[model samples]
Target: MKKLVLTGAAGRLGSYLREPLTKMCDELVSTDRVDDIGTLYPGESYVQADLSSLDAMLEVIKGADMVVHFGAIGDEAPWDDILQSNIIGAYNVWEAAYRCGVKRVVYASSVHAVGMHLKTDTIGLDAPHRPDTYYGLAKCFCEDLASLYWDKRGVESVCMRIFSCAQATNARSIGTWLSYDDLIHLVERSIDSPVVGFTVVYGISNNDRAVVDNSKAGHLGYRPKDNAEVFAKAVFADTPPLDNKDLANLCIGGPFATVELGNSGVAALGVVDDRKET
Candidate 1:
């Protein structure tokens, strides 16, 4: 690719992506609303922009070949916050991609998009949307937006429904954990895939207890290199006894599965960083 644009550059995932993204293209333009995001790599540059503003997004995306859009209120928040950051922000990303002649958008969708589904049921990429919270609902909307962009506007997209891209700390993470290396690899595959009109794949490693089926997206060749099973013994040893009645334990989205529509499951569970700092 000639140029690649990444939103949410100040974010944790964004920091991990900076070097790899820069190596993938001639120029990597990273942006976020924050004033700065620490130091930068040789081939990477930063921009300050809001996701809700189409004009700002368009300007940042100008002359880019593809966009990796991860900018949004990443946690479950009040309806107003979710509406502006996730909903409107997603719209701005897609619409701006279309207007700027960008080829594809790689979104950081979440498992919350279908969290209400029972963990016992092994669902595929085509599972119906059953968002656990407003944050999840926003992901659902973006998936639909990706579909619309493909069906009507000819732009392509790949929505990676990330399970849990963090350190293994509990029983749930044994099945849902997506290692940092795997996360970078997933993003790379999403961008480099030969043809992905509008695909959705679980952003998970080869975990033994993983619940979601990613076979439908097999055509994209997203072969995960890490496995959460390696950490199972240590994780289970440290994990507290499971509370069967807890929505978090029973729901597929884990913490999100049990959270209220406007609550913050991410915060409640404590910080799980992918190491955004330089």
Candidate 2:
């Protein structure tokens, strides 16, 4: 592609994607709310832009061939905050992509969109929205937004419902983990695929204990290489047995399902800040 725009360039997941994205396009424009993201790759540039502002989104996405949208308040927060950054931000992204004629948007959606479902249910791509928190609710809105844009505006999108994209430190992560290597592969497939009108794929590794199913999205060619079962022994040995009564242990959303509406679910997950350095 000639140009690729990546939002949330300063975030943990965005940091890991910057260097690799540079190689895919002639120019990679990385944008975020931060003033700077330290260093950039050879063909990459940084643009400081807020997700809530439609003008800002338009300016940053103006000449992009495709957009990898990861910019948002990643954790649960107050209603107003979720409305501005996640909901409105999502609308701005799709609108900008429509206006600017961008081909596809690879969104970083979360599993919390269906967090209330039982872990044993094995959620598919067609699962109905059952958000656990305000943050999760925002994700549900964006997924629908992606669908609407595709159906009405001819803008393609792939909403990847990512689970835990960190190390398998907790027992829940053993079933939800998405390794960095696998993440890169998934993003690559989402970008390089020939045609995808409107798709929803679970961003998970090849874990034996995974509760989500991706059989429906096989056309995207996202074959995960890492498995969380490798950490099964240590995680199980360190953590206590699951209590089925606890929502965190019983639901697919893990800690997110148990947190208060406006509280931060990430804080409860105890996820390590192991972002890759650029």
Candidate 3:
């Protein structure tokens, strides 16, 4: 590809993706609201942009072959915030991509988009949206927007509904964890694949106890190499036993599944201060 643009360049996942993404394109344009980004890959350049403003987004994606959109307030924020970042920002990306003639969009969608679904039932790419929070609702809106762009304007999209993608701290992560190495592989396949009109794949590893189903969108050739199961023994032993009566514990979204709309589940988890250095 001539150019690849990544939206959430300062994010933890985005930081990890920079080196690999830089190698895939002659120019890798990384953008975020934050002003500082520590080291950069040889071909990578940083751009400061906002999600809500179409002009800002368009300016960053002007000369790109494809876009990897990971920008936005990642956790559950206020309704207005979600409206601007997740909703409006998502539209700006697709619209700008269409107007600028970008071929494909690789999105960082979330499992919270379908978090309210029961864990017992294995959901696929086509599952109906049961967003656990306003944040999740934004994901649903973008997925639909991707579909609309594909059907109407011929711009392709790939929405990967990621599960828990962090350090494996608890048992829930064992089923939802998506390792950094596996994540790099997934994005590579999404970019190099021959053609994909509009597809949704679970952003998860090949774990022994994965809860989500990915068979419906297996054509992308995303074969994850990591597994969270190895950490299960230590994680489960150190944590408290499961609370069967709690809807938050049993549901697929975990705390997100039961938290009231507009509430912050991330706060309850306490301070997560780790920032990826470039």
lDDT of 2 by residue, 1-278 (tens): 99999999898999889988999999999999988898789999999999999999999999999999999999999999999999999899999999999999999999999999998999898889999999999999999999999999999999999999987899999999999889889999999999999999999999999999999999999999899999999989998777879999999998889888899899978889988776
- What shift in Å separates residue 101 of candidate 2 from its native position after superposition? 0.7
Clashes of each: 0, 0, 0
Model 3 over residues 1-278: C-alpha lDDT tens digits? 89999999888888888899998999999999988787778998888889899999889999899999999988888899999899999999999999999999999999989988877787877789998999999999999999999999999999999877778887778888888889889999999998999999999999998888999888999999899989999989998988888877776777887777888866654334555664
TM-score of each: 0.97, 0.99, 0.97
Ranking by lDDT: 2, 1, 3
Clashing pairs in 3: none
User: Candidate 1: lDDT over CA atoms?
Assistant: 0.89
What Cα-based lDDT does every candidate model obtain? 0.89, 0.93, 0.88
lDDT, candidate 2, at 70: 95
- Give the worst 10-residue stretch by lDDT in candidate 1: 268-277
Give me candidate 3's TM-score against the actual structure. Answer: 0.97
Candidate 1 per-residue lDDT, tens place, 53-92, comes to 9899989999999999988988899999999999999999
Candidate 1: give its CA RMSD in angstroms: 1.2
Model 1 reaches what TM-score against the true structure? 0.97
The positional error of residue 135 in candidate 3, measured at the CA in angstroms, is 0.5
